[model samples]
Target: MPFIVTDACIQCKYTDCVSVCPMDCFVEGPNFVVIDPEGCIDCSVCVPQCPVDAIVNAAEVSPQQAEFVELNARLARAPGWRPLTQAKAPMDGHEQWAGVAGKRAHLRLTW
Candidate 1:
């Protein structure tokens, strides 16, 4: 199974995970990120890179966050999602976007 981006990643979109993804499986969404199960190699590189611990393998994901696995897969196949580079570096620093827990700012508008 592929790595999943949990709700913790909403609005934050830390992007550190995006840089380390070996298969370019991470795709940017309006307010969050999604993993392409079809392309992910399960390298687990993105897991540690996420500052909020939003990236988790399907099997290891908490039950509450489990829906993200399918959400990532579905968004990955959706039209307009762009493929990120796999050879980039881990995102540095703290979470930039605040109040993500209260509102899904990324989902409010189409990107």
Candidate 2:
């Protein structure tokens, strides 16, 4: 199964995971990053790289994180969500948003 980017990454938008993805499957948005299901090689290298522990295996997602399995795929292909291959600064105010729950509502679909 492909790795899924979950709500923990919503407002944080940390790109540390992007730096370790061998397939370069990450797609960037204004406040999130998703793994392209089609491009991800299931390497799991990006998992530990995510400081917020947002990346999870598709088969292992919890009930709350289930939506992200499809969300990651959909967002990766969404218009204006482009491929991200390098590590960059996290979103503004990421420190305060880190570990904050219910961040799905703040997810930005476009850049």
Candidate 3:
């Protein structure tokens, strides 16, 4: 299964995951990133690159964050989605939200 970027990624918006993805499966939004399920190779390289540990192996996704699997896939395939191939500085003030829970509600689904 592919790795799914989840709620912990909401305000953190780190591009570390994008830098190591062999398949270039990641898509970007204004304040978030999602891996395109169809494109991910399941190589698992992107997992450790995430500083917040926000990326979860799809099979291991907990019920609390299960919705994000589809969320990643949906947003990845959304119209006008763009590939984020280069790592940039994460959103400012990322430390404030790194461990914050229930951040799914704050995900910005568009660029």
Return the top candidate by lDDT: 2
Per residue, candidate 1 scores C-alpha lDDT tens digits across 1-111 of 777887777766677777777677778766667888898888898889877777888989877776778788888877777776653333232245442453333452247
- Which regions of candidate 2 fall more than 4 Å away from where they truly are? none
Candidate 1 — worst ten consecutive residues by lDDT sum? 86-95
Q: What is the C-alpha lDDT of each candidate?
A: 0.71, 0.91, 0.88
Tell me the tens digit of each residue's lDDT in model 2 across 10-33: 889899999989999999988999
For model 1, the superposed segments whose C-alpha errors exceed 4 Å read 86-109
Candidate 2 total steric clashes: 0
Q: Which stretches of candidate 3 lie over 4 Å from their true place?
A: none
- Residue pairs with colliding backbones in model 1 are 16-91, 31-106
Tens-digit lDDT track for model 3 on 29-63?
Answer: 87888999999889999989998888998999999
lDDT of 3 at 59: 95
- TM-scores, one per candidate: 0.78, 0.97, 0.94
Residue 35 lDDT in candidate 2 = 95
Number of the predicted model whose TM-score against the real structure is largest: 2
Worst 10 residues of 3 by lDDT: 102-111
